[model samples]
Every structure is written in structure tokens, then in C-alpha cells.
Target: MTRRTTLNLPQLRAFLAVVDAGGFSAAAAELGMSQSAVSHAVASLERELAAPLLIRAHPVRTTVLGERVLPHARMALSAVRSVEQLAAEATGTMTGTVRLAATPTVCQGLVPGLLRHWREDQPLVTVRVFEGDSSEVSAWLEDGTADAAVLIDPPPATAGSYPHPGVQLATDGYRALLPRDHPLAEEPAIDLRDLEDDPFLISPNGCEARVRTIHRLAGLRFSPTHRVRDLATLISMVQAGIGVTVLSEVSRSLIPADLVLLPLKPDTSRRLVLTGPQNRLWHPALRTLADSAAGHLAHTASCTAGPAVGQPLPSRSG
Candidate 1:
């Protein structure tokens, strides 16, 4: 009798977890397994396949075989989730882990509140957030690493693309950040061109393109004195009077008391939306989250105290 080669979800998940987390130890921690157990799983998988999948190193690197196997592993896992989702849908109880991707800003500014609502609305659903730049978030969605994502100013779907439209979560215009003592800090609102003479600090954190567009619209060059990657670093540079910068008004919550946030004249804004996979059927929890977000935003819109989605920002003193 010939022996049958076998693969199981645990083995596949172990392989993927090591590749994604960059090491067996980290992957074990993520999966709540012992490091040796995770290693054993991968080794067993390699034995079953009769090939090496990963190079053992400080940070594990996938062998060619592993690279080839990754997509199939992801697909297998995604299919299992789909089956679970379908069952949950039929039973009228949403339950599963949703891998949600978001840009750093959205993760910091918006996701906590959104997660709170999800926790209450669907108690059985668990959301695991992956925070990255816009490009990384989009790529994760494409590769099936994430079931849903919070997209920033995503372009309109072309013909024959994903049928379900993205649900808008929030809209926020750009605001200029300056040292309290800067010359333009006292103005109610400053024109974009007015800051052309000063050194500009910008973060390439998923908003650089929009900032360039705003500069182009204002008839100024989009050159930056420094391109900072971290939001905290960018805010620090402005606070130290190194340069001024613009950020989404949603970032107001993250700004310190010392940095002055002023409105920009001839304003440009970005729309944040909850979106799901374009090529595959969405996990039912994702659709529920989108609907819940729409209703939550609508409810928030009626309240007077805070900013609302799709509305002009409330005025603030300089």
C-alpha cells in the first residue's frame, strides 16, 4: 500500500505563522504554542512534503519551496474561514476572527472606537488589526492576508470589480501644524502657498500623495525639507520649530497641547472607508462591520459634541 501525503490546517498555519512573524519563537508566541511545538510542526510538514521549506536563521527566511507554498497555504486558511463564515451566516450568528488592515493614523485615531462598537454589536466576532502604510494595507487585502481594510481615499471601483461599494466611515480635511510662536500661527486659516517659504516637514505615511496634490492645487512645489516616517517624529520636528507640516484633522486627538493646529484655506480632505476583498467573497462579519459602521457614523453625526463623518470640520481658534 502506498502512503498518502497529508497536510493539516495546523501544519499550514505553523508554516505561515513562522514566515509572517519572522521566526519560530515569535510565531509560537503569536499562536500560543511552545517554540519547540511550532518547530516540530514545521519539521513534520517538511518531512511529509520531502523538502525543506525554511532556512533556519536568526530571522527565519522561507526557502523557495516555502515561497511557492505560501499562497496555497493562505488560500487554504481563507477557505476554512469562508466555510465557518457561511455556517455562521446560515445560523444567524456571526463568529470568526476578522483580519482587519488599516493605516497607522486610522489605527490610532479611529479603530479603537470602531472595535468597541464591533465588540458590542457582535460579541462572538474577534477582530485582529494589522496596521501598515496605505500600500501595505492594500497589498494585504489583495493577498488574502486581511479580510477587510480601512482604506484612505481609495479610488472608485472600475467596471466588473468588487460589486459591494465601500462604506464611508469618516472624512477629515488637512490641517496645518505649526509652532505656537510661528508667524502664521495666529491666523484663523493659512493659505497653503503662504507656507512655501518655510521649511516643510512631511511624513510619507500614506498621505504624501494627497499632500502633493494639495500643493499642486495651490500652485506650489511639493518638496519636503525632511521625509519622516513616524508620526511622532513628524510632530516633534514641528514642535521643535524645525519645520511646519500638514496632517489630517483626525490627528487632532494625537497632537500635543503645545502644537497649534490651524485650518487650511482651499481645503482638501480624505475619505476613510471600510472595504473588503475585491476578488473573493467577504467574510460575513466584514459586511456586518461595514453596516454597523454606517449606522454608528450616522448616529454620531446627530450628536453636537464631536466631529462627524462627511461634514466640514468644526471651527477652532488659533
Candidate 2:
């Protein structure tokens, strides 16, 4: 006959905690259980294994066998946590943190609006935001550092694309930002080639990628005389007549009063995208984020300046 024993989750956790905490009493306090309960759990685990897992002494410590099993126990606990999270996501009873990553502009321009709406809907889901450059944002999703992201679309669909599910959130076009007294400021629509000689400024969060893409689309040589990474600083520089750059209309709220935003002759626009891991159902909170962002964009589409882009330029009189 073979001896068999089934170990419970409580037994495994108690055993690991007692070994780590160096005592039953400490593990009990950490687990919110009585010391006797903690001791019983560990004893149950030991009986299941048919081995002496710990040595009771002035200061409790694990035995050699316990040391060997500890790593496996930890891995099991981690797997259990993953299962629990997936189940929670599936049931839409999302609680705890939903980690998010986004480009700097999205962090300022879109994330806040989405989160504000999310707060009203899913108050139990805590969202944590991490701001990065475009590539960094993608890396966070792939590396499991983030549960979701707000990004510009169309995503890099080439080989080595972000391995995840994605959706478009909103559609908005770009416009040029210049000082009110700039030479071509009076033009109703400005061609990309019109400002060839002017010094260009790349706006907050290293919007160099968008600048490069615009140059490619327009078949023009593009170079920024200065790169500005802070939104407020970029606005101040433009207001001071430092240089000109393109901005998404959704970002109009961040624009200062002294600058002028003009439509582009050949319009260029972007669709905001939301993405999550491909391996599992997006954490319920992440799904909510995508839905909330889409709904917010739709709700704000008919009117300018509610949440995302789609705003008509403000008059110079203001």
C-alpha cells in the first residue's frame, strides 16, 4: 500500500510563512490566524509529506527537507494567485490594482479622462499608471509589468508586434501650434511645407515619433531644433515664440492662451488604442478601461473639449 496525503492551500501557506517568519506566532499574526491554527496548518502539511519540516527551538527554523520544498511551495502559491486573478477577471468582480502603461501624451491627454469616468463606474478597481515612451509602453505589456495600455494606433503589426488584444478608442486629427504672431499664423490651413524654414519644437514626452511620421507622410525633411519633454514647458516655449510643432486636438486643454492652433491642409490623424495581454481575458478592470475610454470618446465626439480630442480651435480673442 502507498501512503498518500493531500495538502491544502492553507497548509502550504502556513508552512511557508512560518518558515519565513521564523516562528508560528509571527506567521499567525501575519495571516490573521491564531498561533495554534498556524501550528496545526504546518503540522498538517508535514504529516501530508510524511516528513519533519521544521525544528522547534528557541528560534524556530526549517529542516533540510523544508528548505528543499520551499521553492516548489512558493511557485505553487504564485500559480494559485494567477488563477485567482484570472477568475476574478472572468467574473468581473475586479478588485485590487490594474497596472497600466501609456505614452506620456496619453498619460496626460487621455488617461486622466478615462480614469475619471472609470472612477464613477468601477470604483473598486484601483488603476495604477506608468508613463513611458511608445516602445517602453509596449515592452511593459509584453513583459507582464502592466495589465493594459493606452497607445496610438495603428499598432506595429509587423513581426514582433505587441502580442496582445487591442482596440481603437477615438479618432482625432493633428494641427500645428505656433505663436500668435508667427509669419503664417493667419492662414486658415497650413501646408507642411510652408514652415520648412522655421525651427521646430518637439512637444512633451518626446513626441519625436509623431514628428518623424509626419515628415515621412509629407515627404519633407524634419528635424527639431529643441526637444521639450514637459507639457507646460513646451507650451511656454511656443508662447515665447521659440518654435512650432503639431499637436492632437484632444490636447487643446493643455494648450496655453498665447498660441495659435491651425488645421493642416492635408489632414493627419491618429486613433487612440487600448491593449492587454493575449494570454488571458483582460483583467476585468482593464476591459472596463477600454470600454470606458471608448464610451467616453463617443460621448465626447459630438462636442469638443469633454474628454478626448475633437475640438475646434479656440478663437484668438480669448
- lDDT (0 to 1) per candidate: 0.84, 0.72
- Candidate 1 local lDDT, residue 61: 94
Write candidate 2's Cα lDDT for 1-318 as tens digits: 998789889998898778755788977876779999998998888888999989997478779998888767765765675676678767867665577888766777777877888888778878878888878887766655566877666444333432334556657578888988888989998888888888888853555676678887888877789887776787788888778888876677677777888897558777667777554345545655555655565667766655544322111121
- TM-score to native of every candidate shown: 0.89, 0.63
Clashes per candidate, residues 3 or more apart or on different chains: 0, 1
Best by TM-score: 1
Candidate 1 worst ten-residue window by lDDT: 309-318
List ranges where model 2 is wrong by over 4 Å.
Answer: 1-82, 85-92, 154-165, 203-205, 279-281, 299-318
Assess the local accuracy of residue 147 in candidate 2 as a C-alpha lDDT between 0 and 100. Answer: 68
